[model samples]
Target: MKTTFKKLAMPAVATASALALVACGAPADDTATDETMADETSVAQEPGTIVAVAQGNDDFSTLVTAVTAAELGETLSGEGPFTVFAPTNAAFEKLPEGTLETLTAPEGKEQLTSILTYHVVEGAIDAATLTNAIESNDGSYEIATVNGGSLTATIQDGNVVLTDAAGGTSTVTATDVAASNGMIHVIDTVLMPG
Candidate 1:
């Protein structure tokens, strides 16, 4: 399927806007705005964006490579309050043989971006918020993804489990890894979108 990214704006322009906001003085909530600005600024001035956070972790090498192949580094690094369910290297290894190669190849860029974006939600959803959502929504909550897909989240054995569009499951190994642009929850499998 062809995936047209209508949600994400140009990363360069987003970054510039962030910088300009900081330069021009922020909103009325100076304290809160300062904190937000710091987070966004760190994404560019320091290794603090979601992309940078993944690149720094050894286990996310495969994810990093896929993001690079998809040319989504800038977008993921931009001023986003995104929530990402990051799959580890072991997760990528679990894909059918040669799947990784295809996803990372130039021809596979579209599918790769779609898959990558599927793991992301528009807002920063922390573990507590996720658990609350699950509890409040009749034991399962449908999380809308950036790729125009949905992931059903439920609690299993005290761990958060995500059901992809293909009905594949991924357990959240770690939660609430903070980034300049958002939060990252480590998942054990790569989520497939239907």
Candidate 2:
């Protein structure tokens, strides 16, 4: 029995050593297979699954301001498959100087929520799916926003563009940030709810 055990252990140790060598980039017969497996696992994992990207990003200052003003920090941080059209700081800066200040005022909470929710879609929509929907609709698609109003979607230059009821258009700058509960798409301009 002892000799049998020793023989089994010898092969096991050799196999482990061979695996370690392969992991360290040593030439192996199945290196390609290993790499493929690694890629698959990594790709399956989602990146930036938190609202931290919205908070930490300097370019999203306007969005951050609105979120803070609306007291939606906790809600957005909650489990959500929320697609946010996050306007850049530069986008907000385009507004009148007092516009942001007024929006963030204490009495403007309701209005702030309306504005922020207008930018949010309930589902994760990638640029491709949005484009397909628009094309199938004869160059236009409608998305019901969290604010209870529908926004128009159009395909432009191979990108999905959203137009608010106020005649403002926002282009999707980033897409498909997957989270545990949902996905987020970053936009370049604020979307106003009608």
Candidate 3:
């Protein structure tokens, strides 16, 4: 079946216009404003799946290559509604010397796939939802990943941070990059599951 994709941009409020405000109605509170902003930011992109969305973004090139190499492109493209904490190319660069190269090699596909899957949670979790989850869980929440490991979500310095199984922490650099199937939260560091 053919797919349709959407492009989303955060801080979608480029400028304030009286007409826009009058048409949409004003938000009730600070929380309401944030929720409204999040809703407005979810714009549509090209017609495809989450995999295509990641491929289209230059920042995620390394992630795309890794996913393809790991033979997970199709699965990510499937009807997921997944929450993908995609690490940037710079994040991959943060790895130790030879780490990325070794992981991308044919023999390292299994390990690479495991690590990549660790970044994914099997649902559509946007910033507001995640914040709510954290609040409900009393400041931090543990999430089981597709790779069968778990990650901890917490608020630090007023931003959402994810702690992986190996204890490395990655801050959510960008949130709510909406796709056809799910959402992408950009991270500066790759989460290690082992």
Candidate 4:
């Protein structure tokens, strides 16, 4: 998994740069303009773009590592409407010492995948929708993840808090980075998978 990070990051960056370059190379004619517009439209249409942006952030080192370890870098980077509750590196550091290292080990790949998948829902759910769902549900909202587990969302101290299958909790610190495929909500703590 440690090696996986370096391997995956490079390709991800190259792909993004290539996409950017292609987006920038359009000619100034009406047809080219329309094509450029369509390109932008497609890029904006992807919901997982936010995950790419989040992955590029240094604050998300642990999240990146987990993604690599779980072998989910490609999946999250793919086109889809996914709502991710991303935790910062500091959140991972708060875990017991050696926990992170263990999770990245070969034997722990399954667990790592489960934990990371717990943070993702199948569709783009914005903050407003999450808030309204919680409010309408009397402080509890249920979300089904792509991993087949369920997460329980609720409002605590005016913040959206998500409970994982393992009973671990993560509070949404930042919300709503719109991508063509989904939305991202930054969390202060990593929610461990049950």
TM-score of each: 0.77, 0.71, 0.76, 0.73
How many residue pairs collide in each prediction? Answer: 0, 1, 5, 7
| Candidate 4: segments with Cα more than 4 A from true spot | 1-48
Candidate 3 vs candidate 4: which has greater TM-score?
Answer: 3
Residue 46 in candidate 3 has what lDDT?
26
Report lDDT (CA) for all predictions. 0.80, 0.65, 0.77, 0.71
For candidate 4, write residues 37-154 as lDDT tens digits.
7777666434246556666577887788788888898888777667788888989988899989999999989888887887887766777777887787777877777677777888
**Residue 3 C-alpha lDDT in model 1:** 20
TM-score attained by model 2: 0.71
Model 2 global lDDT (CA atoms, 0 to 1) = 0.65
lDDT of 3 by residue, 1-194 (tens): 11111232333221221112223444566566666676654432122466876776778899999998899999999987787999999999999999988999999999999999999888777788787878777888887788888889899998999998888999998877766677778899999997
Candidate that scores best on lDDT: 1
- Candidate 3 has an lDDT of 0.77
Off by more than 4 A, model 3: 1-47
Weakest ten-residue segment in model 3 by summed lDDT: 13-22
Write down the worst ten-residue block by lDDT for model 2. 1-10
